[model samples]
Target: MNNGVNVTALAVFVLFFLLVTVMGFMASRWRKADNALHLDEWGLGGRSFGTWVTWFLLGGDLYTAYTFVAVPAAVYATGAAGFFAVPYTIIAYPLVFLFLPRLWSVSRVHGYVTPADFVRGRYGSKALSLVVALTGILATMPYIALQLVGIQAVLDVLGVGGGAGSNWFVKDLPLFIAFGVLAAYTYSSGLRAPALIAFVKDALIYIVIIVAVIYIPMRLGGYGHIFDTAAQKFSTPKSPGSLILAENKQWTYATLALGSALALFMYPHSVTGVLASKSRNTVRRNMAIMPAYSLMLGLLALLGFMAIAAGVGSGVKGFNAQLSVPQLFENMFPDWFTGVAFAAIGIGALVPAAIMSIAAANLFTRNVYKEFIRPDATAADETRVAKLASLLVKVGALAFVLTMDKQAAINLQLLGGLWILQTFVSIVGGLFTRWFHHWALFAGWAAGMVYGTYQAYGIASPATKHFGGSAANIPVIGEIGYIGLTAFVLNLAVAVVLTLVLRALKAPVGTDETDPDDYGAEAGDPKTQNAPVPAAAH
Candidate 1:
């Protein structure tokens, strides 16, 4: 690494940063609406994005800075096991293809701004909707924090941030500045900011990854030498890694992949992307093409092996494995190109962080604030509250980054997936049927949240004592697996059993306001275009 600042690279990084910052502020005018003050316009970009726009928006939202920094970081640290992300993403697109269009149709017909809105309308239980909304907001905090962590990794390698031992203010000032810029643009332009910026973010990422996979290998002799070096590193007798999955970890690998696939679209931000599309066909078309990102993710994961070959973290005392890919770029690429790579990671952070805060804000405004605090809130009021809430959400995420471990961005996200997955039975199950008693679904969600949190808390890694990992021993089966999937199973069981008991006792099951036709509604249909904005139950 360079002994001091990489001036050429830092200049290039700053230039791209300024360009995106300009674009972010200008996005409020990109697709100008009649009245931009309504929640539908500000929070969902007027729910009018077409296939290509939605494609890039979803691409930017789903394939985040975490994908760029953390996935390879995990591969750099744990060898082949890190590649679980690749398969899980592939699995996720196919799974979402089945349900997302249904969600879009229903959301369009009712003007539902959030998944929690659908839960509110579907189950007619304020309590159930409240839990779903709170879970989404809670789970999103750490996920947003992971994005900031990704940006921090880039800044650290660029020699912009002070060392780990510096005063906290000195160390974190750069992150705070980035956070401020993101919050300002998001608050000002709302979803339009990220939607517009995603085009630039996705293009830079594709360019950087494509170049890295090809250019870095030729500089490292070839893929043959790269794989050999990675294998030899993992083969060191004390190392707990391997060039391939170990037989003992196969269950963990498979479970994590399957569990993650199930939970991916369950995230409020993911659903927000789908709901923002102009039509159900746009959503379906995007899903079919979304797997292209999975292919990029596969190539991106190879950077881990390339980092190993490049000796990125070798012999550095107490090195953060998260820095492997960034350091590798600095070591191998020219300073100017290194700046571009850093910008890709930096802007990658902005796009999703903006969307996540907006999603969390929408949940809070529609479910918590409107339903409980102010049922009389108008469309303009909802948008204003959501905008403010978005700022607060980013503040909370910044706190997470300031306080929590930044050892690996992937672990932070998995920790969130564990909590967010608990809502799947409520949201996804509600989509297909209302067979679940609202109260029973509540019971199931509560049970899953308690169990998932407890299991994750007891998992200890070398880095910390609690919530250190996402895997643990599967109950009864006694095999190790993902805690999230295990909790999801228990959630399903509780909901199913309680539903039967509730039915036998003749307990009240809340009304579902939607009709069968609502699920088939499209953008220009009278039912969809004329649908009234959902109001909170009095």
Candidate 2:
């Protein structure tokens, strides 16, 4: 019930903050490249990450700040249904396993930096590439902001409370300090910083989870009792339903998970991480080994129930249920362990925020600035622009926290998820075949983005009671929804129909820019330098 900061806990937090700061700058030399000056070396970490490196990098990239906070928060507020994150993680690797290799080979063969770069070359449409790039940058800003939110969440738990009244610096100084550290390292070390620091990030997360999962349960009672208590607490007679979902939500869960898996790799950060891998085997092994993180996630989700059983909100009145985990640890453990838990959350926020900002910046540089604004921009110029852009992305994310509702920021993330998913058809589908025309694909992307954004804006949840709720909508025939999946359907439909229309008009179908055989090729593969490397590790 104590609300004051624990000085011992604060010291442990300070130690982690300093450690990651050192790790970030030191990462520049970890995977020494022929030349760090090259765009490939700086932007993509030399395109030379080995299997273990890629494993940690991709795990760090995909399992993000939201995974650490929102998933567990969802479990605390709801019940078993919040476990949707687990299935999504399970399905994503296998689903991406099918298409990512093809993407890697094509990108490597063509020297493509962004998926938009691939679309531009393959379908020969600057306009289409612009759309993809813009979508990526737009979707990514809120994502980057959410990472800040993750950092804020952890900092909030650590008792790094805001200053008096609306004082700007006091309220935001912690955020500024965290992001400044992140931006500086990302600017200096590029992808290598996150690639290397991911090792530390993942290790700490594992340690935290293992300790909390075992110790928290033993201290409280047991898993069954915890869940049983949570079920009782959250159960509602007004709805005449258990806290968990019925059969209907299960279908929605499965569909959303499947849709999310397809969307997962389409996000530019996911591609940026994958492209950093040294070989196909690295990517494959990353996918194969990354599931271990999911085990941690399953445990993390249970913290919600543990929070309930510990009577996290029992003593207090009107305490934010989202603060359940923080309270749980504070009450059960001494100040020292509490600090470690807070450090885990804080560091977790920084690593992915750094990666997401870098990824978004690279997309803007490669696909937007170089492609559109300065076709002849030098590597140094590109790097400088990226560094500046990364800062702006972080600042923009901070603006989200300041200007918008914190709860609204959460919904914006789901909207980002939906928008990014639409790119799947062009990015992943095109990897296997160039059958879809540039114009067709462009049309598909446009339609999907608009529809998805609109639908997301219209969605009203019971809690928020406004826009942004469930991903699926109840339909007449077979609960057919999942905005990402729906947008994808619209995207494919537009692509297919337009392909036929464009063909009938005998319009020039842009050259088949990528060779399919190159999907299986590697460094020795012919014609590799002209395009960006596709899913290289797996």
Candidate 3:
């Protein structure tokens, strides 16, 4: 396996890539909106997706390129610790099931294009909205880049190394072309592009996973040997108590899992999928069943162990742990099946990448650009600005991949999880009651932001010298734990204390535009009706 392109794999990847590119552009007409230029039309696909489409969109949004690439990689390298991705997904569904219906209902009623718009309407504070949008955009950048990292993993296995050189443009030309197609179609088709492509992505992913899970274990002398072999490898002094979480590492795993569960739905990309649903019922129905994806995730994580069992990692040159699952497929399967698996991984990057860019773009347009720059801007203006911002977001993520090592993308996303978790006090709490003062919420966010950043920056790991990791020492628990969870605790406590003190001081709590009835709204409910357009939706 020299660093030379495999003709068969490259051919398969190009055909699938071109297929989705066409589907993405044509999706602008899918369930064609009467006026397809507005945010509601372009950004949210006219907010008319039913159960099936919403399922695929949410699956594509949450089960990302990172999950497919990183989860297995983590388990292969760190043993039971990597299973944090498993419980996080398991717990996230129930939590989102409880709250997302309300978010969807209120967003549809208020014509909120992004979570930041929800914050602005609920708290009536553009300042808080900007903070929310900025946090979301900052957090999403690493995540989007990680998707490209996943694509690069597949590309690397197919014998495309981009060759180490200073000719950056020539070396990264293939990556540029792939994402350029992504940015172009996402700009034209908007949410509909991802909503349609998600079906294809999920189908390919399901097919690949089922085949791998069933076929790989049999080849590895069955599942029992895979575990036994993994246990032996992790039993050395360098990794004492590694196959299972050590006594001291339990808190780290638990906190990371809980923090991740909390942060998952809070991401703007996740919210974008929820808001695109036609009805609140659609959100609930999908959450009820999204655990099916979690099941697949557990299977995928096992691939890491399978790679170790097959001794797949030792054979390859330039082997990264991130390539565990991809390299495993290439080693175990024939060329045609390897081509299919590579295509699946490649397509998987596109769905979440498109949705995330669109989501981040919507935040900048509605909250930052429109709210700050042009208060009277028309809907058409917002859409146009979003299309361009989406392109820039992709470009920023691409730059992240080319300049830094791939592990940095994962670490940056860990930092992002800590930062975005601060918004729970403002965004999630605002969904239920108005008792939490917006000013207090902002202060809470600041406290968490400062504390989490300092902690994350101080963390030193093997990958980098500073901003090294997301796990840190817990304050009260007196153990290593996830920094994000600790920060959220700070955020919630500050919001609580400040809410009481501010009320005593007679500080102004902003007016809430949404009524209580809006929380229970479903499709066709009067409260769920779209708010009057501001002349620009025409």
Give the C-alpha lDDT of model 2.
0.79
Error of 3 at 192 (Å): 0.6
Q: Give each prediction's root-mean-square deviation over alpha carbons.
A: 2.1, 3.3, 1.7
List candidate 3 segments past 4 Å from native: 161-166, 315-319, 533-538
Top-lDDT candidate index: 1
**Pairs of residues at least 3 apart in sequence or in different chains that clash in candidate 3:** none
Candidate 1 per-residue lDDT, tens place, 1-538, comes to 5546789999999999999999999999999877777888889998999999999999999999878987888898899999999999989988988889999999999889999999999999999999999999988988898899889888888898776577999988989889999999999999999999999999999999999999999999999999999999999998868888999899999999999999999899999999999999999999999999999999999999999999997888778888888899999999999999999999999999999999999999999999999998888888889999999999988987888667444456677898899999999998899899999999999999999989988888888777789899999999999999999999999999999999999998788999988888888899987887533322
What C-alpha lDDT values do all the predictions have?
0.91, 0.79, 0.88
lDDT of 3: 0.88
lDDT of 1 at 373: 96
Regions of model 2 farther than 4 Å from truth = 162-166, 238-244, 315-318, 462-465, 472-480, 526-538
lDDT of 2 by residue, 150-215 (tens): 777666666676534648778677888887888888888989998888888888888878999999
Error of 1 at 11 (Å): 0.6
User: Would you estimate the TM-scores of all the predictions?
Assistant: 0.97, 0.94, 0.97
Q: What does candidate 2 score on TM?
A: 0.94
Off by over 4 Å in 1: 163-166, 407-412, 533-538
